[model samples]
Target chain A: MSTSITLLIPLLLGIGGFIVATSRARRFSDVGSGKMHSLPKYHGYLVALSIIVPAYLIIFLWLFFEQSVLRGVIVNALPDALTNGATPAQVSLLISQVQQAASGATFGNPDPAIVEVAGRLREAVVFSRWALPLVIVLVGLATAAVLVSRIAKRFRARNYSEAIMRGLLIFCATLSILATLGILLSLLFEGLQFFSRVSPIEFFFGTRWDPQIAIRPDQIGSSGAFGAIPVFMGTLTIAFTALFVAIPVGIFAAIYMAEFASPHVRGVVKPLIELLAGIPTIVYGFFAVLVISPFIREWLGSIGIAVSPTAAIVPGLVMGVMLIPFISSLSDDAITAVPQSLKDGSLGLGANRAETVTKVLLPAALPGIVGGVLLATTRAIGETMIVVMAAGLTANMTVNPLQGVTTVTVQIVALLTGDTEFDNPKTLAAFGLGLTLFLATLLLNLVAIQIVKRFREQYD
Target chain B: MMENVSFATAGAHARAPEMPVKMFGRKVEVFYGQKQALHGVDLEIPERQVTALIGPSGCGKSTFLRCLNRMNDTVAIARVVGDIRLDGEDIYDKSIDVVELRARVGMVFQKPNPFPKSIFENVAYGPRIHGLFKNKAHLQEIVETSLKRAGLFEEVKDRLDEPGTGLSGGQQQRLCIARAIAVSPEVILMDEPCSALDPIATATVEELIDELKQNYTIVIVTHSMQQAARVSQRTAMFHLGRIVEVGPTEKMFSNPDDKRTQDYITGRFG
Candidate 1:
């Protein structure tokens, strides 16, 4: 039978076991005190689950290992001259070539000894495809029959089912957490690999940031520099520009929504503000490139100053608008959470609305606002598309926002975007930059959490 | 001004005539949305004395107390249709700035609501915002005097810079009172300030309230009849959104003229 049809064998066995077990359970309860330990359906579920889980697990395992084991056996059976002292990469490539020849795909002229092995590989592949399903069907049916015999009135099917459910829930939760740690660890390892080739001090503190390396043995002017200071400083300058735009406008807009605007206005305006965030960063990058940069150039040119269309401030400014909703939404929640009684207390003391907001409300909500600001800062620093498209790729060290500059993320993209060797520092630098970005965001989140915790403790 | 329309129309026939009214409300009514919380009611608060509003839960006594300083203004839909005068000036008039009115008539909430700040900053907040003090030493003196009068200085004097939230429940309430007093208002409103405190703290705050009556006109709303009797010179009994009786504390406790007041005070039912 085909593999696709073979999947139905386990499912059919499970359904048959459930039917037989549930009938037996129902009869046992009806003939006795009518007090089965668990319900008849639970007994069915227990039998069904036992039949399905083990059967499917065996099928999956067989399918997973069948090809690798067959390939290894075929490789061993090949003539000594073909396999002797071969490196792993060479042997693996030969095995793939053999497999390709077996599949009737054109692989150039092969020796007669190799032709014999390719024929053997085809025979093995066909045999295993059939053997795997046959074994699976037999194992699935046998397991189902055994489980059917075990289902009884007193079986603790509910407990067993619940335990499995709990295990599954924990597995799913751990799966995501593990994925995050896995990403961070992979970044760290690759970054370490990059650092092995590049000296730490030169990479970190060196002023020059050229990342081009010589491709030919006699190529000149190919001494690559990997100093990250200029890139990081560019990131900081851009992030600060975004913050300078975001904090006041964001917080005041938040205050207006929380304290001043009518519910009707807030309901419409708040979502409209958040819509800025929902727009793709690529779109913001496009806007920065086409609209904002030209406006800045034209405006500055009129004033007898000049700037590249790809000035850092162009992306930085649009990024600030994108971050505004991010800050305002969180700040709104923080401000809204301050107790009304505190406001009353201040107002009752004859502090005007402005005085109450400035002295009492803001201070009480300060920690929360700081947390929001930190989160927004991290987001701005990690932002890629806008900087890549609008901010030039030159890792300039100048603090002047109008000059073209590149951020760490922008450089990381540039480094790894095209076909490149992983061993080269230029390409591996992408992973290093990724690790740094991850650590920066992780630290900001840690601080934000601590600030939020301190704020909660104050109220509690 | 409301003596004629009140349940105590016999003020002229009473033994202790009413002191010159410090603040009076005429035909006061409060509405939360469409529901009337306080029916048309008239009440007078005499100067330099503690007057307590005693009633069962949801009896409009607290509602009436909130109305005195227009504290209800904070509630968006809470409507007050009445004339409330503070020292003979209509406080509800559009010309009167609510901020200045609040500074002149400070309020203490039922729950202690001290700002999340140092104890010293908590007291100095009102003055700093209102420009109540001209210099640092002047501000310090005002804070110390307010704390002293609230009877909390000696315990917290050494730790004035500590967070106000760190104080115990009773101390926090006292700190709230000190914060209110720092504004140096002519009248102070207390809304069940001692309810959250223990018996000993309750006694301490009650004694302080009695001492404070010699300086400021105090209006307090209390659930405890004994608390009302112990701290107030005049007690007003409210029932079903109306004033059931108003008299001197001794008379209100001993020989209440209204049947509802007698029942409420005698613990027949609240």
Candidate 2:
């Protein structure tokens, strides 16, 4: 059976159960001497959930454990002569050969024992495919019959349906949290592996970052240096430059929008400003590469100062343009969150508009604004596409924005782009940089949340 | 007929030998977008006295109070027509800078809204903005005197560096009053300044208002009739966006000339 058909069987069963249960519930309401406790639609939803949940559970569980169980079965069924003293890697290799033969992609000639095992694997796959849909249909029908029989005028179907809805929401929320945790764990594990190969002291504190490891023992260059300070410094330089550009412009824009702009102008202009965020970062990347970088180079050259075409300022400035809406929108929310009574108090005290905003409104809104700036900083730190397209590949420890410097994200991309063995320190170094970036961003987010929480406590 | 009677009382009050008009409104009408909020309100605020505007909710008393300082200019849709004068100068004239006018006519709002700054900073903000001091000591003197005048200095002087928002509700209101006084405005407009306060706090504020009127002309809007009778010398009763009566506070409460005022004072209908 095809995968789509297998999926469709349970869906069709659920829809059929819905229709049947709905009509039955309607009939119960008509015959009973009281009003239905739950709506007929809720009854339909309850029946549908009963059918779909159990059926999909079985299908997913079967699919999840099928491959490993099949591999175990094949390993167990192999003759003692073939498996007796083989290492796990050799056994895994033999299993792949068997799978290749099973899929009719075998090369040259094959041994009789291996060919027999391949035949058995093929038969098992076919049987499992057919068995899955059969079992799903049986479970769906069984659950549908059980739930439909229990539907009554006073069944309280809405409660059951709502419970299922709540479970679904919890499941979605947990799924995202679990995904984040999974990424963190994977980064930690791989980063640990990288550290095992390269000392943590050298990786963290060393000022040089060269991840190119010689493939051969006698290669021209020595082994790669994984000092992350330069990359971290590059990231900081660009992020700070971006903030330098973004903070003043974004804050002024927010102030103007929140305090000075008329409602008619704000309604039109706010969305137009926010539209800057909607432009994809990748588009911003190319815009930086194709437009800003060369312009900076030419403009600087004319001023009798030399600058790289991929100077840190190019992507830094462009990313700031990209972040303008982000900072402005968040800042606008913070500014607008300030109570009008404060503004009135200041104005009533004979302060002018600018005086009120600077002396009263800004101080009151400082925590919220700081939180927003921190969030934007994290965004600038983690921004990849613009850095990748417009930043240099070399990690240089320079404070000058006119020079080219590579960030952790750019280096991570450079390290992992082509074919490479995962076990090598070169590839594992990407994980190390990733963990570093993640920790930095996580720290920033925690601080931002703390500041924002304090701001809320002030108002509430 | 009711308008004529209210005008006659206002005229009589304005002609009183001891009291001089500080702020006057002549047929002041306020419109918010297309909705008319105040209709031809005529009232006079006497110098060094508390004039209370008394009405039920949505009666436009606060509207008329805000019109005294042109605080209505802050509301985008609010439009004020007719003449409102401060010390016999037309306040709505383009030549009269609103900022300077506000410095001469300060306001206190219904809620206690102190700047999220230290107690000292909150009181000093007005002086700092207006450049009212020659030195830091002068600024400090202004702050101390303002706080003392608002009767908050004795309570808050120990924690002058603490955030003003951390003060109790009543203290915060007093802090706001101190802030308003720091600039030394001639007239003060208070819009239900004690509504958000407790009874004890309200009493303290009412007493402070009585004392403040000796130096500053005060116009207050209050929902509580008892609060009006207790704090104000002259009272104006607003109903349905128009003044039904204007007279001495004791007469308005005891023997109002208009039936609406009589009914309102006796709790027949608001």
Q: What local lDDT does model 1 show for residue A234? A: 90
Candidate 1 segments exceeding 4 Å error: A1-159, B1-17
TM-scores of all candidate predictions against the true structure:
0.89, 0.90
Q: Which candidate leads in TM-score? A: 2
Model 2 agreement with the true structure over A70-111: per-residue lDDT tens digits: 998789767889999999999998999899989999889987
Candidate 2, B183-253: lDDT as tens digits: 99999899999999999999899889978977999899998877787777899999989998998886787
Pull out the clashing pairs in model 1.
none
Cα miss at A93, model 1 (Å)?
Answer: 6.0
Q: lDDT of all predictions, in order shown?
A: 0.86, 0.89
Instruction: Please tell me what DockQ candidate 1 reaches.
Output: 0.70
Each prediction's interface RMSD?
A: 0.8, 0.8
Task: Output the lDDT of residue B145, model 1.
Answer: 100
